[model samples]
Target: MISMHKIFRRLIVFSILLQLLIACPLQAFAESEEAIFAGGCFWCLEHDLEKLDGVVSAESGYSGGDLINPTYQDHSGHQEVVKVVFDSDIISYKDLLKQYWVNIDPFDNNGQFCDRGYSYKPVIFTSNQEQKRDAKESQETISVGLNIPLEQLKVDIVESKVFWLAENYHQDFAVKNPLKYNFYRSSCGRDNRLKKVWGEYKY
Candidate 1:
């Protein structure tokens, strides 16, 4: 038989254990995930991806480059990428892949739109094997839909590298500078080309 104090102590420990069991998985489920993509201007990508339902945040950044601690001024080798943090429970990674496909021209290898350089090249950076597999599957599906060979699809499905966040001003340039963002996006011919390439299926 246990003493009252020992019984009370055991009850307390059991309560703590119960709390951990209930809270741990909920905390894990609440955690968001990051997906990196380089599709022309980071500003536009940030703007477009954030509009999606499950996206928690879209931050402009530089990745797939050799530079260490790169900045907007000296990021020559880096591609302008957007680091999107999203809720996996709310949206599937495969759907995000589809959204990425419609938003940019996969055929262009030089760069996307008015931005002409390796830095603006469209890419999908996968952080894990599952992501890589899904990205490739999405790529293949798009290739089949367009009747283009897999090699013809210029968009890359590379393993994610170090992502250097861009300057504060560059983060949400679209939301902050609506007029300029619209002007730049329009002048760059992003929307028109997207409509032409994606047709009625444009996102």
Candidate 2:
């Protein structure tokens, strides 16, 4: 028994509501950006980066390798990396890079903390020219601030390769296995090394 006028008004209202809903998500998606980094242990890096204010998620993964479907035990040539998705409106990529330097030892080319070999090497994986430029600039800023030579900064800034998501059990490892992760992190001399390298710098 609804009049045509009322029905047309209802349709108009519904159309406006649908447009708003669709536009909101598209706007958010446009503001979202991603950056990848490898600072030794994926569990520790993932845990650390996710704590940043604007970061949406930090996912553990493997990158800079050719292996397809790499696994924890057999990811040869792959580095343990964390893919960080962040809201660009809330935080800048430069800020994230600053945090990254404090969390890692740039002098250690072999590996990070107790973790060794190729998989643990520190790296900044850039997805585009802008990221690469930002990373280099950040590295230079850190070197000057720390009074260290640029050549001494061992963290490689390279173009990002295909990022293979780690196994389900490896995701959110610190959250899932806090006690064990804590014990391992403590025993690995990570904090001590970071303190020596960064000298009370808060990340």
Candidate 3:
């Protein structure tokens, strides 16, 4: 009879454990995700964002162009962009925006680094209206809080209609050809100029 009591207690405990497990909401766990930017060559930002702890993937692409299907040659009018997939749990959107700001020359309205023209210029293609608001608000904060003056040109925070992946050859161009990537980056002078403008800024 005493042994029966122990069995009852064990059964009750097991039932409670099973109930507890069932009670756990099935909502998907927070996972890392994507955030994109087209500040310049995808290679430039790709390398920087990939260094973060939770970033899963970074691919360069084309966005905000009028062309229906833009290719490298046809991408003439399109901006060079990067699509970064990361673990959202590990890195917040605000942090990603901060990382974006650190890379581009907010003061220069033209293409970032050494690259010139609208195609290489800075633009934050937002995933949603909330992100749009956040991007604008962030820029305003950076202007006042960050030491580097805004180039006085309007920062384009456009809604992305579609993000077309770049050709296979362009994917991870930096990783595939380290020498070429390094040479392109250096010649563009993106790093030196960015450091000069933002290295001292608090943002």
* Arranged by lDDT, best first: 2, 1, 3
Query: How do the residues 1-203 of candidate 3 rate in per-residue lDDT, one tens digit apiece?
Result: 56988999999999998887788633233475567688878888888887887677788889888887898787866888998887777777777888888888776658776777888888888888777888887888787886446556345888875788989988878889999989998988888888887777775
Candidate that would win on TM-score: 2
The local distance difference test score of model 1 is 0.90
Candidate lDDT values, in order: 0.90, 0.92, 0.80
Better of 2 and 3 by TM-score: 2
| lDDT leader | 2
| Candidate 1 residue pairs in clash (backbone atoms < 3 Å) | none
lDDT of 1 by residue, 52-167 (tens): 99888899999998889999988978899999988888888888989999999999989998889899999999999999999999998998888779999999889899999999
Question: What ranges in model 2 sit over 4 Å off?
Answer: 1-30, 201-203
Q: Clash number for model 2?
A: 0
